[model samples]
Each structure stands twice: as C-alpha cells, then as structure tokens.
Target: MNGPNDWFQQNQDRYRREQYERQQAYLRQPQRPTGPPVRQRRAGRRGPSPLVVFVFSAVGLLVGEAVNWFKDVGPVFSSVCTVVAGLIPLLLDYWKSVAEEPAPGRGRAGAPSYDRGGTAAGRVLGVLVFIVVAGAAAYGISWGVGYVTGNETVRAERLVSPVAGRADSMTITVEGVGVTDHYTKVRISAVSRAPTAVDVGVGHDCQLVDDGGQTLQPSTVANDQTLLVPANGVTVRAVITFTGRPAPTATTLTLDFSWFLAHDFGFGAHSLQVHEIKLKADPA
Candidate 1:
C-alpha cells in the first residue's frame, strides 16, 4: 500500500493536468471577430409627437371657451365643439400614419415598428374628450333642474289697530305669487292688559273695543278676508277682536300664518292673552 503523502501528491498532479488541458482547448478555439457594435434604436416610431396632441387639446378648450363667451352657448354645445375640435387633428394624424404604412402582408419594417394609430397619445386624447363632453352635459342638466323646482314668490303684510285704553287688535295677510295650485291660511292673535278679552267671529265680524270708549271694526283691519286668489297673484287675510276694561296701558297682538294653500287654505285660530298692560302715556 502507498503512504498517505505519496497518494495525495499523485492526486494533485492529476487534477492540475486536467485543468491545463481544458484551458488549452478553450484557447485553441477561433476568436469571434468584433465588428462595429450595433446601437439599440429607441422605442416608438417618430410619429406625431406628444406635443402635437397637447397643442390640439389646448386649442380645442380655448375655442370652446370663446364660443361660450360670445354666443352664450350652453354647456352641451360648448362641449360638443370642444370634442370635435380636439379630435379633428388627432384623426388627421392617424389617417396620415395609416397612409404612410406599408400594406398588410408586406415584409416587416426594421425591428417591427409600432403602428401610430390608436397609440398611447391617441388614447390620452380620447379620455380627455370624453371627460369634457360628460362634464358639460351634467352641468346643464343640474342647472335646468334647479330652475324648475325652486321656491315660489311669497308676500306678507301686518295690520295693527290704533292704541286704545285697554285693548288692541291686529291682522296679518300673506299672499303667494307664481304659486301654482296651492292655498293660503292665515292665523291672528290678540294680547292685552286691563282685563282684555277675545271674541272669535266670521270674516267681517272681528273688532276691538276699549274701556275708554274707543272701538275698531273689521273694515279698519287689512288682510282680514279670504278670497280665491289666482296662482299668479293671490292674497289671504285674518281678522281678530279684542275687548277689555279701562286702564292706562298698551297691548301687543301677534299674527301668524300656517298650513296655507292656493285653492283651499286651512289653519287653527291662534291668540295670545296677557293681563298686564304697559301704557305709553304720551305719543311722540
């Protein structure tokens, strides 16, 4: 048997020989000729530049604004004009590209050039056009709806009787204008000191009397009657009566309207009563 050192020496020598032989074979192979390095072409054909798309879109928006300002054109018309103007240039560019390209089944161009039609730039333009048109339509619809459903015209008036020794009366009238198919209801209330009292009566019977011998009738009150006022212009009235004992005092009356209709109005009789009277001794 060989000793351990002799066996190790022999194996090392065999491995070195195998490595040298592989290196020699690699070196003997023919060297590849290095010609001028081919440069990589940049992606995308030299079609209509992005700058063109941007310019066209900007021009379209400007034209739309001009039309809107000069002709008072509504959003629909403005948006239509904008889309048409913007697309016109893009369409022309697409057609030009199509015309320049070789017919189908022809030999491929260098490195499979991309078709300019429906390119990234064109898609971006299409999105912009769609947004403009949709936005304008929505704005116009909202404006029309608001104009139709808004509040109608309303007019209100208050009538107060002259001050008396212990009683006071007041009337309130509310009218509607441009209110179609609606009715009106009016409510009146009286309050006073010096033992004042209220008497609810028909449209013509409402009155106010004081202990100082002063009196007021319905004729003295304004908006005390109800009539079928037209929807175009109609008015409703309320009448209240107040009577009381003698005292040097002033009274305050309040009038309110509720549940008003155009053709037939309804509201409950309302009144406010107080027993304390504050009198203005002298009129300025």
Candidate 2:
C-alpha cells in the first residue's frame, strides 16, 4: 500500500494538471472585448482664442481714439475710456474661467485644471490686454492729476507787487494783467529820461512773485525769442507774460523785472534795483 507522502504527491500533481487544462480552455474560447470598450470621453471646447483677445483689444483702442475725436475729449479722458473698454472683455473672460466646465475626455478631476482662458493662446492674449489697459489707466490718472493741480495754482487770488523801488529818473508801474490764448498777460509801464527809444529786453522770460512769498511760473512754455521793444516816448508801455503752469495762482501776482531803461545808451550795466509791481488779471 502507498504511504501518506506518496498519496499527497499524486493528489498535488492531479490538481496542477486540472488547473493548466482549465486555463488553456479559457484562452482558446473567443475573448469578449476588454472591460466594455473604454468609454470614450469627449474633450470640451476651450475659451476665446488668443487671436480673438488681441483683435478685441485693438478694436477698443481704435474706438477710444474715435470717441475722443467725436467728443473732443481731453487726453486723460480718452485714455481712461480706452482702459475701461479694454478691461471689460478681460473681466468677462476671467469670470468664464472661474466657472469653466470639464472638457471632453477629461474627468471631473480635470475641472480644477481649467485655465482662466479656454486655450493657452487665449490666456496669453488676455494677459497682454490687461497689461495694456492698466498702463493706459495709470497714464490717464497721472495726467489728470497734473492738469488739475496746475490749473488751480494758476487761478488763485492775485497779490500786488511791492512799491516800485526809488530809483534815478525811472518810474515802473504795474498796468494790469489780461488773459490771452497763451497765458495771463502782464502789462507794465515805465518812464525813463533816455535820449532815444530804449531797447527794453524782457530777457527771454519773467516770473510772478506772490505776497505769501510764493513764486509763480508761467502756464505756457517760455518763448525763447520773446522781446519787448518799447515805443519812443518818455513813458513806455509794453505787454509781457510769464510761465504760469508751474506757478501758483493768486488774486494778484507780483511782476518782478529789471527795468532796463536804455540798454542802447552809455548807461551800460549802471541801473536801478529790480522793479516789483503788483498785477491782477482782468476778470474772466
């Protein structure tokens, strides 16, 4: 009779043979398609393309220019409007991005990966648009601030100049101030005992001094070739102006000038002290 070990070995060999036969039978049978055809996942659509964003921004810029022309808007106003217009589209795109749905072929897990702009191109274009708008807005704000400040300073109350210095045979009087296309023009009168008409060189430019010890600059650019040639007379009157854009506005501005009676005569540099005359611009 066979012992326990002999019997165990025989049983194990029979089991192995059965398993191999079963596996071969399975392999020979027609195999069904694996795991129900991988469910085809669709990729959803993307957001606005980069080209679209770029085009929209360009159009916005053109529209802004047109509006400025039609409305005669200031530079600051035009720039501000353009910035606002350009940003509207960008804002919309951002909102869409924040609410983007899952794309086809991409699962719910991919939703979080949705970019602000649908496509890479779109995102890049959107960024460029934002940059342009931001720059324009900043520029507008700066320009507006400067303009308002400058106007206020030039429109303040005026202060009269100190009494004309006592000098030899010279009388400098502050006639008045008037508004011209260029600026608040200053008028001054001077009577000098000179033989011929004096060459009164207004000297390139002038400045307005206020009683509060504030110095005023001209509102307009200084005319490098500006000169005032007084008529031949004992009493000479001339029109002059100063740079006021940078100067403070006041009810009265002290007109300070070196009264050059007769630069043509032998008087040479021998002259009186600087003449200060208070000036007030005519009512607007």
Candidate 3:
C-alpha cells in the first residue's frame, strides 16, 4: 500500500542490508583459495656430477702413472692406488643416484614409476668395471717391473769326467758350485774316448778288471755313467770298466754337466755347463 517513492526506498534498504550481511559474513569467515594449492617442484640435494667423477678418475690414473715413473716402487702398488682412487668416486655416484631415486609405487596415477636410482644391474656393472680396471692396472705394473729388472743370471760349474781306465776299473768324479735367483736341476754325463758317445764295454781282446780284474757287466758299465748334481758346490763320482785284449789302447774319457733355472716370478731361465777329460791305459 506504499507509494512509488516508498516502495523504492524499501527496495534500496533491503538491498543495502543484504550487501552488509554478505560483507560481514566474508569478514567473519577465514580466507580460502578458490582452487587447489599449487605444488612446487622440490629441489634435490646437490651432489657431485658424473662429469666431475670422470675427471677425478682420470686424474687419479695419471697420478698413479706419475708415481710409478718417478719412484722405484713396483708397478703393482702404484696401479692399485690408481684403481682404488678412480673407483671410489664412481661408486659414490652410483650410490647417490640410487638414494635420490623415488622408490617403487611412489608415482602419480597413470605416470610410469621410474627407479631413477641405479638398478641392481647397473650396480653389478659398476663393480665389474672397477675390478677390470684394478686388474689391468696391476698387470701393467708387474710387466713394468719385469721389464726394468731384466733377466737374471746364475753361475755353475761341473766336472765332466773324473775316472779313466784301460782294461781297468776306475771312478770318475764331477764337481761344481754356483749361485742363482731360482732353483735349478743339474745332470752330468761321462763318456769314453769321445765326449758324445757312451761306451760300457771293450772288444779289442782287452777286458775291464774288477778288483778281481774280471770283465764288468754292461749294466755295471752303464750304471756308472751318469750323476745328478745340486745347485750348490757338489762332488759326485761314478765307476766304470774297460775290456780289450790289446790292453785296450789308451782311451780318452769326457764329462759334461748342464742345468736349467726354474722360477715362478716370470723371470727367464739361466743355465751353465762344465767339462773334464781323462786318459786310461793298460795297467802295467
């Protein structure tokens, strides 16, 4: 029943009240964002870079080689140091990569879960690389040492023939002495008339006599033909007989000794020889 002016005034008042109530409500309530909170990319822990690791490894190798060049130390030691130094940083990088990677089942929906960290396969490969590098370095060092040392030598002597007889039995003798960086086995031989021929019997109507002057058996003759000598100074002897009717013309006997050095250090072998001669004639 109000006039136009009155109705207008009432409408204005209602509108103002509603606006005031809305303002009051807004002031009383906590401020809230209209949308979801923005997620920020997290910064990862800073670590040494792969490039840095590689550079350090190279430096280590160079340092190791330098040490070997300047010092008389064995190649093995220097190479080991190089390998260990080079591998440490690599191993650390591998471990760090593994630590920074997200574990399984941690990715968002529909997103592929990546094990950014090293896998078991990668770790195994790294270890194998380290071992290979180490082994190669060690071998290089050993070779260097051997090259520098050169081949070693030892001296030895042996008496080739100590006994001589014609239709007579006599004992031959051998002797020797020497030094070596390794163990060696020695053999000595005695021959009649010719240093190259082993003779156990005579046929010219002459016969070797034992103390009883009896002809010696071929086995007995050959049995006394060889001797084994040791590395150090040693004296060895063998007895043999000659048989011939013409009193077995005077005969010459010869002895020869030889040896070979044996060792495990990759050093080459060494050897020596010695000889002796004697004459035998019919026993007056």
RMSD of each: 23.1, 13.0, 20.8
Per residue, candidate 2 scores C-alpha lDDT tens digits across 119-194 of 6686678667776765575456534533542211123323355345334545566655544322454556776555
Using Cα atoms with residue i matched to residue i, what is each candidate's TM-score against the true structure?
0.27, 0.33, 0.28
Report the alpha-carbon TM-score of model 1 versus the true structure.
0.27
lDDT winner between 1 and 2, please give it: 2
**Candidate 1, 148-200: lDDT as tens digits:** 42211112222132321222232223111111111111233322221223233
* Local distance difference test, candidate 3: 0.41
lDDT for residue 209 in candidate 1, whole number 0-100: 34
lDDT of 3 by residue, 1-284 (tens): 78999999999999999999999999999765554343333355333565775566556666655665445344555556666766777668657766755665564544433344445697678668866876586656555543433211222322223433221112223222111222111222332222122222112212222222333221232233433322223333433222222113423222222222222312222222222232234333
Candidates' C-alpha lDDT: 0.40, 0.51, 0.41
Best by TM-score: 2
Ranked candidates, highest lDDT first: 2, 3, 1
Identify the runs in model 2 with alpha carbons over 4 angstroms from their true place: 1-166, 179-182, 217-232, 245-252, 259-264, 270-284
Comparing candidate 1 with candidate 3, which one achieves the higher lDDT? 3
